[model samples]
Target chain A: MVAHETLSRRSVGSDLRAMGAVAGKELTIARRYPSFLIAVLVWPVLLPLAYILGAKALAGPHGGSLPAFEAATGTTDYVGFIVIGTLLWGWLNMTLWDVGFFIRNEQMRGTLESNWLCPVPRGALLIGATLTKLALSLLFLVISIVEFRLLLGVNLLQGNLALTLLIIALIIPSIYGLGIAFASLVIRFKEANAMVFLVRGVFMIFAGMTFPIAVLPGWMQAVAMALPLTYAIAAMRAVVLNGAGLADIRGDLLALVAFGVALPIVGYLAFGHMARRARRHGDLGQY
Target chain B: MTATLSAPSWRSNLRAMTAIARKDFIQYLRYPMNAVFNVLQPLIWLTPVYFLGKTFASPVGNVGFAGYSGTTDYMSFILIGTVLANFITTVFWGMGYSLKTEMDAGVLESNWAAPVPRPVFLVGRTLASITITAAMSVVMLILGAWLFGFHVSGNVLAALGVAVPMLIALYGFGFAFAALVLLMRDANTMIDVSNFLVTLLSGSQFPVTVLPTLVLLVSLALPLTYGFDAVRGLLLGTNTLLPIPVEVLLLIVFMVVMVWVGLVVFRRVERRCRVLGTLNMH
Candidate 1:
């Protein structure tokens, strides 16, 4: 009876250790590729550049269309508005590709099956990768702020810094939650790039990355409201660009909090179902 | 035993290229969803740009944009750019990303060991994708016209004439990039960033005149900028940076220079990789 109990029961402490080990392993592998550092520096400036230039041309040589843009977005600083939106969207995009494809990459490397054979909870492996992604995302954010300020002459730090941090913290759960759910779907569908294009393309069109949601058609606006990034971008723009306090962004905050709570639960349920199905069917190695 | 091999000729080269293109086309058709997405993906990217133009409308049909590019038909300008940009993407992917894909599949070295000339192999890889891109560009343009009201008022054959040199020049650029992929072993970030930068700097989404002074200089230096500008000028009657004839002259000159430089660089780098025995390492 004692031996059976010991075999069946594993402590939370062991899972935590496994998570840390996986995170460290991922971090080490990431460091092996130094060129990624170039991406970290280059993307923040380059990603928003074309849109900013497009806006410049649209504003005309003498800034004639500034009135229309200012009226649509409520700020003449299209650069700030675009930068904030793309930054958050870029974070979500990276998380989707990095954490969502983690399992598939492991499978391709032939490490996933062996890792699944271990006694640790399979969720811990994913969570461990998520932790590394979070760390890298944080690094990306810091670099983005410096690069944007220097290159584009936009100040992302001019906002209420504390509120900006809080907004980032709140958006984390939704981002990773969607990523977890996405990872499971990729496992089931076995088409990683197609799935990524479909999912990210939805956000790109609906989330007002380069334009205000108010500019979208009525149905598209409805879809934008349903996405967490719409609120996150709106809230970040409000605080960072408009200098709005907590009160000005209360609605966006509440919406983000709701998504933050709901998405993770949905993600966990989806991941749990996928893990069981893969193990039962012995399909964990198939992809 | 003596084995006599057929002397290499244009006919044999053509046969080799046809075989390579056929294999790639077969593999591409095996994934129907990917083929479908190739048509949809550009439209997906264009949606925001479409809405972005809508946001800037002043009830006078993009009068502000007209001040920059000489026309308020912003979607038309963008759609033309998109059509030209599609060929650029095909060349980049066909030469660079395909090499990376072959490397990951552990077949690149074996494929290279064939008796065919290496440059022929690279060009053959692009043939299927180029055909597909052209077909999809037509469908995308039709969808753009229906959805965003994009229409071309210029001579289609003339626009194609300007585009031919630009596409050939891109082949030269792709060869150099493929050599880089051979060296780097990782292609995603490099390809993504470079592709985005090239298209953006070439004024795919907006007029290059609006760029800051330094960036505009960079834009003018890229041969693709003239390619985009001349095509848009012809199709939409938008402003061109130079006289149309001069731009065409520049593109022809660029095509000659880039192809020569590209072939030289690729041969040198590929030889270096073979010496280092790193062709199959990735």
Candidate 2:
């Protein structure tokens, strides 16, 4: 009875420690791979370069079609528009790969079963892994902002920096909430790559990453509205490009708040269900 | 008075290649969802591009795009590029990542121990990927046309004829790439980055004229750029980077040189891996 009381009281502190350890382990593994670091640096510049060039091609030599693009999107600054959209999407893609597959990777490496045997909460471990990915994503975003300025001449911080930060903070829960829920689903489905492709593909097609959502069909617009990324990208473009104030983006912010609150609760519930299911089925070790 | 189970003969090599191809094909089919996604993923990527092109279109056509590529049918221009890019991906991943997969499975050494020529084994691994890519490309193109209104006005047969040498050159490059994968033992990042970069620089998504001056020079230096240019020229009547005859000749020359160089580099690296006993280390 005394031991149980002590264990219950110390649980929160112990879970925090477990999360930190997992984060440290992931960061260490990331540092050991030079290719991973290279990819982090290269992809920010490389991925958007294609779209920027495509936009340039469409704009013609003397900027003949800039008016059409400007009409579709608010600004003729296609570089800045494309950069912001692709950067956020890249973060989502990275999270899907890292957090979504964290458990499956451990399973494949034969450490997951042993790790599950620990006294720590499994949710703590998943969040711990997510913490490292979250850190890497922050680094990716910083790199992208600098690279876009230096290489592409697109200054992401030209507008309201405080509002931009607020948008990022608001979207954090939604992105990772979706990732955590995706992690649970991936554990159940076992087709990690396909699941990642499906989820990210949905966002890529529906989130208006390279083009404005106004260009999408009416049905596609309705589908786009259902995704949190659509709001995130739209809000980001407003603050960063058009220098929209808080009053201008209240609807987006409110929608993000709703997603932020709802998604994590859903994620935790899904994760609980999956964890219980895995333990009951005796399939924690299966990949 | 003994029967040979394995022999180093031309006929035996052909059988070994066929077996390898068949095995890969079977393994691919085992993942039914993956097989389906393989065809759908490219289409998903194209949807955004299709929308992006629409954003730039006028009532007539993409008048701005026509200024660069001399084609108002932007979807057709992009579709042809996408098909060629798919083949490039097949070659890069087929040879490099196939060897990496074998290494991870702990089968590289045992597979190399067989009597078949090493080049045959490497080339054989790609046969399944090439076939799948070709079949998927056809489906992807048909879907692209239906969904995005893709159409080509120029000669399809002649365009394919131009692509033949380019595919051969890519296979040649794949041989050397497989040797590198064998040496490195971890090739996922390298293969992905190189494949994306090569395709990007080779005008797989847009004309090279849109690239920055230095980047355009790098694009010009790649033979695959000429391949994409010539095919687009033949099929879409896009303004060729060079005259059609000159681009075809360049492709033929590149094919011969890359094959010879690829074989030479592959032999030397295979010997080095054998000497160092690193064939089994991934």
Candidate 3:
């Protein structure tokens, strides 16, 4: 019994080490490439500015606090709305591209086979990548918030801060799960970039990143309802814009939790199935 | 006794340019799915912009957009801006990065050693890019008109006139941008930054009148601003910051200046790279 216990302890310790090593490796690579760092910093600022400027132009001297905007979003603080939306959307994108395209990147770098040879579980590898991306995305979000406040005069503090954080924490697991599922598809098809673009576009259109889902036609609303991000964004906006607390957003939280648990399991299964199929077909390195 | 060959005649240069364009066209055709994606990509990008416009649009009219944009048709306004923005992107990002791509593929050295002038080759690539961008623009216009009810009410031919000058100026600008990419030996970050800056300053999704005074001043200096304004004026009857004749003259001046600067910079960079022996470095 003691021997078995020790072995199990050793296995768990080694897995932890491996996961840390993978995450550290990603950070090192990012540090080596200044361009990636520049993109991470610049995109979060520039993308939101585009929309903010658009809103300002459209609002026509009233800035973004228009009655029409208030009627649709329940707040005339359009700058704040867009800033928060862009920050969260940026996180979602980073998670998707980092975790979802992880395998394809490995293949391109000619490291996929060697990575497969490692004793670490594939799930642990994914966890490592997801954690690193989450850290970077959080950093970007903070910087973006600062930029919006300083440059655009957006106020991010007027919200249920704790509840907003809670909603974001809940949403992240589902994003990881979706990333895993996308990574599986990318690995199987060798079309990671195109697939990521198509999926991101769908999310942008249906997930109500910059606007409310109610504005969409009924059929598109149905599609939005099916996406986990749709609920996350709604819950977040409710907490931030409407100052709703936990009780007000319980339904969205529960739905997100359900997605958080369910999608990862589906993703793990799908990845395992695809990996095995690729191995059988001897096509693991085809791309 | 050795016979010396004279510099290639204008006829030979023209022939070489046509040949290079044909080769690029054929190469592009080999990846048929990519061509489809190229056409579809702009539409995908326009979707979010459409929604953003819809979110603020008043139930009855354009929610004060008419005050700035002259036409209350927010959808058509954004569609026109986005289509023109895509063309600018094609010039700056697509054609501008073509040389970098050839270098990555290990063909730049051989191409440089060829008898043809480098500018001719660049012009050929630019022409091919223009053809592809024009086709994509047409498809986007049709898609917008059919699906989203985006209508062009004014003189289409006059709008084309504005677009033609804009394209010339953009091509001239792209040459200098391509030269910078060659010197840097990387295109990703440059392309991303330029794309964002151009989109922001060009009033692609909004009127320039709304920008901060400092930023508005900067926007006025860019050729894209004149081009965008002239095209919008003719197509949607939007108010222009300047008269159409003045805008066209500015575009022509920009075209000449940018082309001159682009050629000078390309030659200087090419000579420097050859001396440094970095032309073949990845």
- Report lDDT (CA) for all predictions: 0.90, 0.90, 0.81
lDDT of 2 by residue, A1-287 (tens): 34663434557877898889999999999889768788888999899888888888988988999899888888999999999999999999998898888888998899998998788888889999999999989998999899888988999987899989999999999999999999999989898999999999999999999998998889999999999999999999999988899999999999999999999999999999999999899998887
Interface RMSD of each: 1.0, 0.9, 2.0
Candidate 3, position A257, lDDT: 91
lDDT of 3: 0.81
Give candidate 1's iRMS in Å, 1 decimal: 1.0
Off by over 4 Å in 1: A1-8, B1-5
How do these models rank on DockQ, best leading?
Answer: 2, 1, 3
Per-residue CA lDDT of candidate 2, range B56-159, in tens?
Answer: 88888799999998988888888899999999999989888988988899988888888778889888998998999999988988888899888888898999
- The TM-scores of chain A alone, one per candidate, are 0.96, 0.96, 0.91
> What DockQ would you assign to candidate 1?
0.79
Give each model a TM-score: 0.96, 0.96, 0.95
Error of 3 at A255 (Å): 1.7
How would you encode candidate 3's per-residue C-alpha lDDT over A1-287 as one tens digit per residue?
A: 34563423548777888789889998887778878778876887788787887787677665433777778888777777777777777777787788887888998888988987787787788778777877887787677767767877775655788877777788877888888888999888776767777888888888887888888999999999888888888887777778888898899999999999999888899889988998899988888
Per-residue lDDT for B175-206 in model 1, tens only?
A: 99999998998888889888989999999999
> What does candidate 2 score on TM?
0.96
